[model samples]
Target: MLNSRFDMKDMDLAHVILGIKISRTSNRLTLDQSHYVDKILEKFSNDDTSLARTPIDTSKHLLKNRGEAVSQVEYSRVIESLMYLMSCTRPEIAFVVNKVCQFMQKPLNSHWKKKKRILGYLNGTVNYGLHFTPTHLYNLTWLVTRMRTGHLIVMMRRSTTGIACFWVQILSLGNQRNKRYTVSRSSTEAEYRSVASLVAEITWIRGLLQEIHVHSSKPPIIWCDNSSTVRLTSNPVLHARTKHIELDLYFVREKVQQKN
Candidate 1:
């Protein structure tokens, strides 16, 4: 406080910080980094490149660089820039950015192409930003889903899990986690493991909300398409087939009982 000898000055408002632009109104707040995006596009000379419908092509196969490596240093720089943007205001590109970042050491042309595609996508969506508006908790919902284990990458044999938390219609967080499950006997086991991870994440979010003095009257509802896994979590009995995943079962079951 001024009387307490605290050093403080009132800045009327904040417009930009670290390339992110903040806009405010009576009832809404929006954040964007259009200028930063433009700089990246110009630096990469992708201003003239055609816009990509998606950030990265899903069908294109990018393997480890057995072929000649492209400009590894440049590729890493581009990826690093994009990563900061993704973590700040552009989470939509996280999946693709994460994918290409794995080959930073020995990036091939295919990897470079995907990296440029991300820049191209950004060029088309420079004005995009996150908008936060007043919303009621009753209208908000969270949905978590996962693919079958070993279904994402045939060679790696890992499953991909996705979580999308919505505050009413607006997305609060949308992200995916790549899970490597020890060879399981069935898809149900893999699905159950994924549920465990989802539960842990939800638990953390709940604690965060509580810290901020946000309270929900009712327990959060999670929708899982796997009925078998759902039953396994609720059932107290352990079956013969589930012995392999006893630890996961115990963790999920404890949370379920605690109404997480």
Candidate 2:
């Protein structure tokens, strides 16, 4: 037969592709790029350095390049490389990457040091990666939502919204938005806005799952520690104090009625 004339060899499993290392087992799959991280560190880091406990230091502040520039081109290249890594498997470093990348045009020594600190952190966590384990088959009872709010310390009055969605305990999607959309009048308003953002995110996820032929027998449940925000979702009455956020109220209420 034609098949008998051909020779094929099985490699068994894939180890690396496009800088991501893929490891698989019967119950889970883990993707990491420790080798790639090591190359990055070796490329950018000095021989004498200490590992950082965190990727970024919140206590320190970064300003525009008022000081002398230091290798802007090289600084940009490092940020670009790290960005690829962050987008691929290291979403935890998103905040720091975003922070350091703002000064690509004229990065200062401080910014360069911060970028190196991120590299150091990556050096410490080179073996870390996302681990995905199998969820219960044919069970649609699993859904998780989280929300948080904070005032932007750098921007003074601006607030931020953070949300994450999980399916079977695995993070499916997450987002953070600085509420330049509208200035919230109070912490409660900011928290309510975050809840609205969470609702919109869940709705989109639900629609995507449906399109992929996955069906949920029951509605998804969202958990919030803010009792006032929880009441706002079900109260159905928009008082004057909540008029600024009226649009969000309608959107969340409609989703709730549909058992989102």
Best model number under lDDT: 1
Residue runs of model 2 more than 4 Å from their true location after superposition:
1-13, 65-68, 137-156, 174-182, 223-227
lDDT of 1 at 222: 71
Candidate 1 minimal-lDDT segment of 10 residues: 146-155
lDDT of 1 by residue, 1-260 (tens): 57469878788789999899999999999999999998888898454477877897877656774457899889989989988888788878877776788788888877777887887788789999889887676333566666543434335655566666665456665355464546555678777887777778778877877898887767776777888998998999999989988998999899879976
Per-prediction CA RMSD (Å): 3.1, 5.0
User: Model 1 misses residue 196 by how many Å?
Assistant: 1.2
Q: What is the C-alpha lDDT profile of model 2 across 55-136, one tens digit per residue?
A: 9887777777356789988998899989888777787787678667767887888788888789879878999887889755
TM-score of 1: 0.84
TM-score to true structure, per model: 0.84, 0.79
Error of 1 at 94 (Å): 1.1
Model 1 CA lDDT for position 247 = 93
Query: Against the true structure, whose TM-score is highest?
Result: 1
Check candidate 1 and list the clashing pairs: none
Candidate lDDT (C-alpha), each: 0.76, 0.73
